[model samples]
Target: MALEIPRDRSPDSSLWLLRDGYQFIEKRARRYGTDIFDTRLLLQRTVCMTGAEAARAFYEHEALQRTGAGPARVQRTLFGQGGVQGLDGAEHRQRKQMFMSLMTPEAIQRLADFSAEQWQARAASWAAAERVVLLDEAEELLCRAVCAWSGIPLPEHEVATRTRDLVLMFESAASVGVKHWQGRLARRRGEAWVADLVRRTRTGELSQGPGQALATIAGHREPDGRLLDERVAAVELLSVLRPTVAVSRFIVFVALALQSSAGSRAKLEAGDLDPEWFVHEVRRFYPFFPFVVARAGEDFEWGGYRIPSGERVLLDLYGTNHDARWWPQPGRFQPERFRDWTGDPFTLIPQGGGDHYAGHRCAGEWVTIALMKTALAFLTTSIRYDVPAQDLRVSLSRIPAAPSSGFVMSNVHRA
Candidate 1:
C-alpha cells in the first residue's frame, strides 16, 4: 500500500523556513503528529524528517547523493564548490581520505596545543582591556591556531581582517539581504586568497613541512589521477579551516553554560566531570546548523512514505539533538547524561553523523572536541573571568545562533 505523508497545506513555505529556523520541521511534526511531512520550500517540494532513524536513512550512500543537493546560496558561502562535502561514492571516498589523513592523533594534539597557547596569549591581552567580547576573541584565536596547524602562514597583521571575513562566511551563511551578500563576497575573497597559495605550493614557491594540511591537500590527487582545481583545493582547505573556527561559537556556549547551568559549571570547577561530556551537552543544547540538506540519490521509502529520486530532503539536525526521546529532560543542561554515551554517531551530531571515512560526517569532529575540551580546561581550571550582565539568550530563529551579547567577560586572569 502506498503511504500518505502529511502535507503542510499552505503556499510557498520559504518564509516559514526562514522564520522558524531550527524548529521549522519539528514544529510541523508536532502539529501533524508525524515525523515525516511534505512541504514546499522556496517554491519547490521538500521532505523534512527528524530522529535517529531519519538520519540513518538520510546518510545511506545509495539513498542520497550530495552533488547538486545544497542551495546555490549555501554552496557559494558555507560549503564552496567542488569540495568533499559535495562529492558522492568513489569520488567522495577518495577526497575524504585526503581530509581524514590530517586527523592523526599527533595532528589533533597540535590543534589543542595551538589553541591552548593562543587562548592563554589572548587572555593575557584581555586582562588589560576593560571588556572583551568572547566571540570576537575566540574567532581570531581559532583562525590563527588553525592556520598554523595547517601550515598556512598567517601574517600577524592580516589576522584581524582574515578572521572576520571567515566568520562572516559562516555567520551569514543563512542570512539574507546585506549579510547574505556579504557572505558571498567573503567566499569569493577567501577562495581567491587560498587559491593563490595552492598555486604557489604546486610550483614550489611555497614550502610546507610534512603532515601539514596545506601540503597534503595540495599534493592530493583524485582517484582518476588528476589534481584538484586550485579553486576546489582552496574550498576543501576552507572546509577544514572554517569549521575549526566555528568551534569558537561552541566555546562561547561553553562559557554560557558555565554561567547559566550552575550544577554543570560547578562540576567543571571541581574537576568532577570530563570536558568531553560538557562539550557533548553544549553541542546538544545549543544550535549550530539548523539542518543538513541533501537530495535523494534514488527512489526510497521510510515509514511508508515514498521518496522519488531527486527529491529535496532536509534532516532536522537541531531537532534530533534536542528531541526528548533521545535526550531525557531534553531542556536541561546536564553533562552526566553523556556519561553512559556509547558513541552513537546519529544521536550526538552537533556536526553531521555516521562513518567519518565513507559518509558525510564531519572530518574534523574530533578536532572540534579536542579544541572544545582545551577551551573548557582553560575556562574551568586555568582562567578567571567575570561574566558581565548582558543578554545571553540564544535565538532559535537565527541559524547558527549564539548568545545575544556574544558572551562578554571582564577581569580576566589566571584561575
Candidate 2:
C-alpha cells in the first residue's frame, strides 16, 4: 500500500529554506505530524526526514548515494569538486581510508596537544589586549595548529590571508550575492594554493615527515592505480584544512555555553564534570552543520511512502539531534545525557551518522571532539576572563551560526 508523502505545496521552497534556515525541515515535520515529508526546493522535488530511524535507513541501508547530490554552489564552494564528499562505493571507501589513517589515537592526541599549545600561546597575547573576539582568534589558532600538524608550512605573514580564505569557504556556503561569490573565489584560491603544494611534494621540491597528511594525500593512488588529479589532491587537502578551521565555530560555542548555562562552568571548574561531556552537549545543543544531502540510491519504500530512485533526500542533522524520541527533553542543554550514552551514531550526529569506515560518517569527528575538549578545558580551567555585555545571540536563520559579537572577552589572563 503506497502512501503519499506530505507535500509543501509550493513550486519552490529555496527561499523558504534560506529564510527559515535550520528549522525549515523540523518545523514542517511538526506541522504535518510526521517525521517525513516531500517538498520542492530549487524547483526540484525533494524529500526531507528526521529522527533516528530515518537516519538508520538513510545511512546504514545504503539507500542514498552522495555523487551528484550536492548542489553546484556547494561543490564550487564548501566541498570543492572531485573530493571524497562527492564519491560513492569503492572510490569513496578508498579515499575515506586515506583520511581515517590520519585519525589514529596517537595522531589525534598530537593534534590536541598542538591545539592546547596554540591556546596557551594565544591567551598570552590576549592578556595584553583590551578585548579579543574569540571567533577571529580561534580561527587563526586552529588554522596554524592544523597546518603544523598536517605538515603544511604556515609562514607568519600568510596566516591571516590563509585563515580568511578558509573562513570564507564555509561562511559563504549558504549566502547570496557578494558573499556567495566570495566563497567561490576562496575555493579557487585555496585549491590553487594546495595544488601547488601537491605538485611540489610530488617533485621532491617540498619534504614532509612520514605519515604527514600532505605527503600521504599526495602519494595516495586510486584503486585503479592512478594518482589523484593534482587539483583533486588539493581539494582533499583543503577538505582536511577547511574543516579544521571551521571547528573554530564549535570553540566559540564552547565559550558561549559556559557563559549561558548556569552552574555548567562551575562543574567543569570544580572537576565535577568531564570536559568531554560539555563538548558533546555543545555539539548537540548548538547549530553547526544543519543537514546533509544525497540522492536515493535506488527505489525504496520507507515510513509507508515510496521514494523513487534519483530523488534528492536531506537527512536533517540538527533536527535529528533534537528529536525528542531519541533525546529526552531534547530542547534543553544537558551534558549529563552522554554520561551513559549508548553511542548510537545515528542519534547524535552533529557531523553525519553511521559507521565511519563503511559509511559516510565524517572522518574528522574524532579530531573535532579532541579539539573541542581541549578548548573547553582551556576556557574553564586554564584561563579567566570577563564576558563583556554584548549580543551573544546565535541566529538559527544563519547557516553555521555563531554569536553575533563573536563572544568577546576582556581582561584575560592565565588561571
* Cα-based lDDT for every prediction: 0.89, 0.92
Provide TM-scores for the models: 0.98, 0.99
The list of candidate 2 runs beyond 4 A from truth reads none
Residues 270-340, candidate 2: write the lDDT tens digits: 89887888898999999989999999979888978999998999999999999988889988888989899
How many residue-pair clashes does candidate 1 contain? 0
Question: What tens-digit string does per-residue lDDT give for candidate 1 at 53-149?
Answer: 8888888648888899899888988889989888899989989999999999999999999999998898778778888998998999999999999
RMSD of each: 1.0, 0.9
Task: Please report the TM-score between candidate 1 and the true structure.
Answer: 0.98
Flag clash pairs in model 1.
Answer: none
